[model samples]
Target: MIRVIVCDDQTLVRTGFVTILDAQPDIEVVGEAGDGLAVVELARRVRPDVVVMDIRMPGLDGIEATRRLAGPGVAEPVRTLVVTTFNLDEYVYEALRAGASGFLLKDATPQQLIAGVRTVAAGDALLAPAVTRRLIGRYGSRVRAADPPGAAGGGGANRSGLAPRELEVLRLIAAGQSNAEIAAALVLSGETVKTYVSRILAKLGLRDRVQAVVYAYRNGLADEMGEY
Candidate 1:
């Protein structure tokens, strides 16, 4: 079973999520918190496989909570999935940067929410299609501008130590290509593509493909203006 913790300030919203997630046989709602401050202790105690976090709470807030739970300095970071009612670009970007594996709109369907939790619990990133496009579009230019010269052209030593093929996989990931699509494009098997993706994430020290996408954009490996 995939252990999970749900955190949200609103009682109705928290209960609704718990209700849907608890019904999944493969998932269990082990703990719940109504404030960000309480969540930190709950997470440490429960050590859940995934955390369904709300962006806004009375204290601490989800972003900071995510940072504490999954940030770079964390020794045993937990995977986090941020759920918010607002689709603000800064919130999405900051959540990811804070080490959240993914984000979903609170209005997402029950199936989507379930799928998202499972995805993150299975160690993959989950971003809504529209959220992905909008995030890339709004933040692409900033990422491109932040890159140093010769970084995108592969002229510099691959910072993440990825090989040529692995770099290609990372780019396709940023382009929002699925494993099957990447496999077809590269004339490789699905398992092979999955392996490549795993290696890429491992080498880059990223939590999942969503962080890989962020890494690609920030490092200029992906075209800022390109449609994903």
Candidate 2:
């Protein structure tokens, strides 16, 4: 079974998500938390496969909770799926950076919700490519001094030792293309695209597609990657 812990500040919303998830035979709702702190503690105690997190809680907000549970250098990072009511939530990108495995809007249908849980449980990201592009383009920046370092704001791809074809694949991945889409665009087999993605992640020390997107933006590859 895919064990999950649902965390939300609103009691009704929390119960609804619990009901929807627990109803799935392949999924089990192991716990529910009304705030970020509670969810963090519950998750540590239970060690669930996935945590359905809400953004605005009374204390410790979901972003921080996600970081604590899944951020870089974590001993054992549990997958987190962040669910929010807003479609253009500002916190979504930060949540991804904090190591959320997937994202879904609260307005999503029950089927989509179930699918998202399964996808995250299976260790696949759940963000739409278009949505990923839009979010990263809007909030992702290489010139921001307060964030981190290593982005000279315009170049860095040549140093990764990626070949021309691999660089093309990296650009597509940063632009939010799936393996199938990348294959279709590059006229390669889907399996080949998967191999390229794996290589990119291994080379760059990235965790998943989400991190690749962030890396592209941070390293100024976003400027060269054309639309979709």
Candidate 3:
């Protein structure tokens, strides 16, 4: 079973999410928190496979909670799925930067929410390429200039330890291309594109494709003007 912890300031929202999630035979709501501060402790205690977090809780916001649970220095990161009523690009970008594996609007259908939790629990990013592209295009420019892509290598693709072909694949991924699309664009097999994606993520120390997209945009590897 996929263990999950639900965190939201509103009791109704928390209950609603739990109800929807618990009905799934493959999922279980092991814990729930109405405050961000408590959610961290709950997560640590439960060690859930996925966390459904809300953004505006009192005490500590979901972004910080996410950072604590899944950020860079974490020895055992838990996958987080950010769910909020607001669809602001800044929130989406920040949540991903804080190590959330996925972001979803609160109005998302029950099926979508269930799918998102399962996807994150299964170690995949719950992002649609088209939606991710839009979010990045709107907020990517706000990223600091000092943090260019390949900052480790003075803004070179080598910083992520990706080969030329892998770099190309990553660029396409940043452009919101699916594996099949990337394969067709590069005239390679689907399996080959998948392999490149895995290699890129492994070398970059990234959690999933969402993080890859964020990294590409933050580092200037992907541009708003780039054709998809």
lDDT of 2 at 150: 19
> Tens-digit lDDT track for model 1 on 90-169?
77777787889989998899999999999999888887655675675467547443432222334234454889788888
- Number of the top candidate by lDDT? 3
Overall local distance difference test of candidate 1: 0.81
Predicted candidate 3 versus true structure: per-residue lDDT over 1-41, tens digit per residue: 99999999999999999999999999999999998889999
What residue pairs are clashing in model 2?
none
lDDT of 2 by residue, 126-157 (tens): 77675777777677773352342212233353
Model 2 quality (TM-score): 0.89
The candidate 1 region of ten consecutive residues with least summed lDDT is 147-156
Alpha-carbon deviation at 134 in model 3, angstroms: 2.6
Error of model 3, residue 168, in angstroms? 2.9
lDDT of each: 0.81, 0.81, 0.83
Residue 114 Cα positional deviation in candidate 2, in Å, after optimal superposition: 1.1
Task: Summing lDDT over every window of 10 consecutive residues in candidate 3, give the lowest-scoring window.
Answer: 149-158
Question: Which one is best on TM-score?
Answer: 2
Runs with alpha carbons beyond 4 Å of true place in candidate 1: 140-156, 224-228
